[model samples]
Target chain A: MKYVNLVVIFSLLTFFACTSSDSDYQVSDIPGGYMPGDTARDFQLKNVNGKMVSLANYENAKGYIVIFTCNTCPYAAMYEERIIELHKKFADKGYPVIAINPNDESEEPGDSYDEMIVQAKEKGYRFPYVQDKTQEITKAYGATNTPHVYVLNKDRKVVYIGSIDNNARDAESADKFYVEDAIKALENNKTPEISKTKAIGCTIKWAS
Target chain B: MIKPMKNVNLVVVFSILTFAACTSSDGDYQGSGTAGKHVVGDTARDFQSEKVIKFPELQEYITTSTDDKVKVINFWATWCAPCIKELPFIDSLRYTYDPDKVEVLLVSLDFPDQLSKVNKLLQRKKLSSTVWLLDESDPNLYIDKVDPSWTGALPATLLVRNSTDQRIFLGKELTKAELETHINKLLN
Candidate 1:
């Protein structure tokens, strides 16, 4: 009986290690993170509404558009209105946009908790704009840039990762809507065809 | 049928290798299009050119395939505070390091509209190293080539030592001493 228990535990450990993409955790070397199909981790962060929220809070959510975005980045600014639109379009479909400001506030005053609230209010963000005070969430997600989006499936699998769209300057010029397309595919019970793309924006401010 | 299958496998492998090779070597993107400007044999002055490199030209740009010159390529943007702060160390690197042995390429990650602003900043700082505006639209396409470890982050620097063909990537802000230490280690 004891031997059986040890075998069961060891097999479980091996299974997890194999299932977790080595690249997602190999973030010790480079900041690139969370390949498609990796399971998402749950976190408790302070939302702009002053409520402590976690992934578990969304009981009815089919999926999530978890964006590592902030107030200071021009790239984030470029996508702010679009992000709000994404939430509006998808929130009713059980996919809501959760914006997290992971930058160290001491380094970036514009991204301070107070400023986050101000930005959310000014933009009239319908979704929860949160803060990762310890940066544990950011590091776990392997978020390297602002406006980096990770689409989570109903099973909590990261279906897609990378930028919201191709165009940074003008939305009218955007030929590819990576995030929207991914969400639509997920809604139809299909995996996103393009699972990963590069996210270009201000590097997440680390407390060096 | 067997012959075609073999060829298909080769094509797949070559595509993967080509992608890996160019990710860090995209520093060589500007090496072409200049006619006898600073040929390897020539004693070059502080090399700075205003040439614009579109995405099409980038497909052919690989500086490592050439001769012995340590290439230091930095990917920076005007909006990034750390990138702006770290520019001087790269500038100082031009004078402190052996110019004949080292070649610095400061590639600005500025957009097309920001060209005048980037040029103004370069002039204000009096940066002597050759500067190039990264004209490619999709950063995802080139950021990996810039440095596979780089998450398209600002203040990413790539150092290529010619003799041993060593390529090193630093994807964060660095002080002057840290810059010197890295280059010296590369040289040795």
Candidate 2:
């Protein structure tokens, strides 16, 4: 009798304790290129000013710092100022920061193109902050998180792929600046020592 | 003769197993992770205490693989949408496999302030699986240790099977079918 009661109680507990939470996480069916030696696929994204921006837009750059970031994620917001600083410090050196928000607006309303424009204007963004229309740009790069950085060379080879640095919360306290170090290495005609460092960041909101 | 209560228990357990077999969908997780130190690797058989473990100890489980059981370490957070999306499926793995063959370590990466939220969610979800807090603050010190393929994403899963030297590292979230396939490979 006791065992029967326990089983009944446990069954009810399982039903009450577990179920769905209405999370609509989407993954792209198309395979992506993420390995270090792969060439990047050229993608066109709409900038905040209603202009189509692609790799050709920055013809003067020696390489590119393609950062996949969004407005809604707290981690992305934390790196906002530092990302601005990255542009300020590296753009002149031919390594410009191109920010892309690949989130689906229906699921992540805060990351919609309209909200992106507002964020760019309010943040005084000096670089191109664009929106991935179909999130194909995100999938082509195999981008998994917001603020995921892929440093590309003149030939569009993914030279450095990973986080901006080891620390996301407190930039000042950061010990290893992965993105900065990669750029600085490229400047000296050397490879970034730590080519890939996978740190945590916000998952890119994929379109359902 | 088995009592009616015993029969009920058997029925419920079998039903749970069936529920575990169905349902599929998973994803990749990327975000900041914290750390701490505990020697969980040394004590896989003793993981039922529900005591919070630090990062180093968890690594011990990975590095040592002392007990030779297949270890499925899932890195997730309470607030992550994808992480929550696949929680039940990940939790279901527990009921599907015998404990002797599989040890599921659910490492929650919630911020220190969000511990209560994690507790509540675990309770509400009825995740009776083994849960741990990745008490590490430094990513550089331990990210590679988890799996070199991971880029710090949530809903990420790592399967470690020492006997076959097989490690399935899915940096993204997984469907139940995908997860089961990996587990079956390890089991085989």
Candidate achieving the largest lDDT = 1
Please provide TM-scores, in order, for all candidate models, with all chains considered together.
0.79, 0.71
lDDT of 1 at A28: 37
lDDT of 1 by residue, B89-129 (tens): 78777678678777787887776545445645664565656
lDDT for position A208 in model 2: 74
Cα lDDT tens digits, model 2, A114-201, are: 9999999999999999999798888888887777889988778888888887777667778888888888888887888877766686
After superposing candidate 1 on the true structure, give the runs of residues whose Cα lies further than 4 Å from its correct spot: A1-33, B1-48, B55-62
* Model 2 misplacement above 4 A: A1-41, A92-94, A106-109, A153-157, B1-54, B66-68, B163-166
Best by DockQ: 1
* TM-score top scorer: 1
Displacement of the residue A34 alpha carbon in candidate 1, Å:
2.8
lDDT of 1 by residue, A57-166 (tens): 99999999999999989888988889999999999999999999989999888899999999999999999999999898898888888989999997779999899988
**Chain B TM-score of every predicted model:** 0.69, 0.70
Extract clashing residue pairs from model 1.
B23-B145, B23-B146, B24-B145
Give residue B40's error in model 1 in angstroms: 32
Docking class of 2: incorrect
